[model samples]
Target: MHRSERVSMYGWIWRHLPGNTWVRAGISLVLVLATVFVLFQYVFPWAEPLLPFGDVTVDEGGAGR
Candidate 1:
């Protein structure tokens, strides 16, 4: 809840991660990449049509004149 609590929580996770710094870094990188891959492959495709970014139009009335 507080700043120290959040920091300690992260510290606990870091301490619990197995292996030395390089191994832990590799594991963290893989986890991050996997999360991104899942989000792009499944989540983004399903949510794309619901987003308002697709069709954009601008009208200048004097263009045809």
Candidate 2:
């Protein structure tokens, strides 16, 4: 197809992308990252720490029990 014809077609499809699409996409990304952070920082610890290499018996700074 001609360049102009292709541009017009692409423009029409681009216009149909909802105004809120970018907002929703951004919010979704933030939500996903927050969830992952929570899982790693809190949720995984509640269940069990993510890495076995980390201390299972000692708290931070390797203080005594």
lDDT of each: 0.84, 0.69
Error of 2 at 41 (Å): 0.3
Candidate 1 lDDT over residue span 1-65, tens digit each: 77766666557767888999999888878878999999999999999999999676866665676
Root-mean-square deviation per candidate? 3.8, 10.7
Q: Least lDDT summed over 10 consecutive residues: which range in candidate 1?
A: 4-13
Per-candidate TM equals 0.67, 0.45
Cα lDDT, model 2, residue 35: 87
| Candidate 2, 1-55: lDDT as tens digits | 7776666754565565555868756666776799899999998878764567665
| CA deviation > 4 Å runs, candidate 1 | 1-3, 6-12, 60-65
Report backbone clashes per prediction.
0, 0
Q: What is the lDDT of residue 2 in candidate 2?
A: 79
For model 2, the superposed segments whose C-alpha errors exceed 4 Å read 1-19, 49-65
Displacement of residue 54 (Cα, Å) in model 1 is 2.4
**Cα shift from native, residue 63, model 1 (Å):** 9.9
